[model samples]
Target: MDTIGHHYIVEAAGCDPNVIGDANKIREIFLEAAKRGNMEVKASYFFKFSPMGVSGVVIVAESHISVHTWPEKGYAALDVYTCGENADPEKAVDYILEQFKAQYAHVSEIKRGIEEEDRTFTHTILTWEERLDRRNGKP
Candidate 1:
């Protein structure tokens, strides 16, 4: 199987103190950022009062973006996961950071793919080998 995708985790600290605690405000921030990043959002939800703070998720056609806000600590956690060659999650991350006016941010990106695995006959060969071994009474 061909697996190609990109996933990003972005965390921000010392966000604009004003924007950190409210779920509604956080939702608005994400909506605006999505527009700025040119991402197509299908649906979104936000919730407040988690131990970690407020949390929200935006389900996008490209993938999804999620945020957790901690106004008490002036921190927010973000994650963006996307598949397909054209999904630019980095733009989304940058837009979010800019919107929140994050003072210190940490971003981690991971590229996913399958490299050099013989897919054609490996399964068939393995099955045949297993059958032969069974016939030979080798558990």
Candidate 2:
């Protein structure tokens, strides 16, 4: 298999507006989620917008989890990307929704790092003729 990563796009709605705007709460929720998902949380940072929103990212050994919340709309958008097969991104999403008490959430999953089989680029693989051409200084 060419894929090496798993990515999840989450659309959360009907969340607790006040909790979504709290940077500290958001960070706490993400940290717990990372732990639950088996991701190593190395560092985290968050910024609270003046009008009422929070944006934060949790950097993990596998990859990262980010959240952008719009409290006024009772919504949050999240992206969870992790390398290797052991990490469970869905667990993280579920925890986030639970933390915010989200009434509804739509999640879309995609496998990353997939290479097409139709063609092979020289950078990836080269035939004997191509190697010889390189040695001969021919394009």
Candidate 3:
């Protein structure tokens, strides 16, 4: 079996308008979501825009979580990417939606991996050539 990477995209609509413009609140939401997903957040940064918006990224060991909020539109877009066992990006998405009191959310999940048969002789030949060149000190 091939190793796989999981990625998630989450969009929330009809979120509380007040929450969108606050950088501190947005940070709280992200931290809470990371905790709920059992993800370790190493660092984060957020910026607040006047007239109502916030944007931020949380650096997590598994990968990262990012969000942008629009208060006027009552909408938020989020991306959660993780590449290892015990990382559930879906849970993080759910936590954010619930925290923002979103009326509805759109979620997408994609699994990334090379198909077994798709890794044919051509791929192997290229890999072998690269290895041989590296071993022979041929740039």
Candidate 4:
């Protein structure tokens, strides 16, 4: 099977710190992104820090979408990963970025698991006698 993952970094210059500190707002943004990306969310959880910040994850049938916020720094990070072809992680990332409304952001994406160039191939030439020897090794 083919697998793909999108990891992103959000750098904010002029964002409301209070918004990032709210767990409910962060969760809402993530759930909306998941819907726009066509991900089937199986479970979800969020945690509010002692004094600031919010962290949460939405477990989806395709894989998962997660987010973490830093109100003090006006920054947030996200990871959207999936194992199948039906989900569009990039769309999710874009939507989340827009929600953040950061003055500036540096975003990136990568393909995870089963990359073609990273694969290895083996070729063997064998006769009937060699094939018999191979079977012996299997046992």
- Highest TM-score, which number? 2
| Model 3 vs. true fold: TM | 0.76
Worst 10 residues of 1 by lDDT: 122-131
- Residue pair clashes in candidate 1: none
Question: Each model's TM-score, in the order given?
Answer: 0.72, 0.79, 0.76, 0.73
lDDT of 1: 0.68
Task: Kindly list the per-residue Cα lDDT of model 3 for residues 58-82, writing each as its tens digit.
Answer: 9988488998899888788878877
Give the candidates in order of lDDT, highest first: 2, 3, 1, 4
- The digit string of per-residue lDDT tens for model 1 on 98-137 reads 6666766666666555344564321111111011222222
lDDT of 1 at 41: 88
At residue 76, candidate 3 shows an lDDT of: 85
Q: Candidates' lDDT values, in order?
A: 0.68, 0.77, 0.72, 0.66
Q: 1-139 in candidate 2: lDDT tens per residue? A: 2346777777877778878989999998999999899998889999999878999999988589999999999888988888777788878877787777777667667666665687532222211111122222211
- Lowest lDDT sum, 10 consecutive residues, model 3, at 122-131
Residue-level lDDT tens digits of model 4 in 24-66: 9878988999999888899999999988888899999858887
Q: Name every residue pair that clashes in candidate 3.
A: none
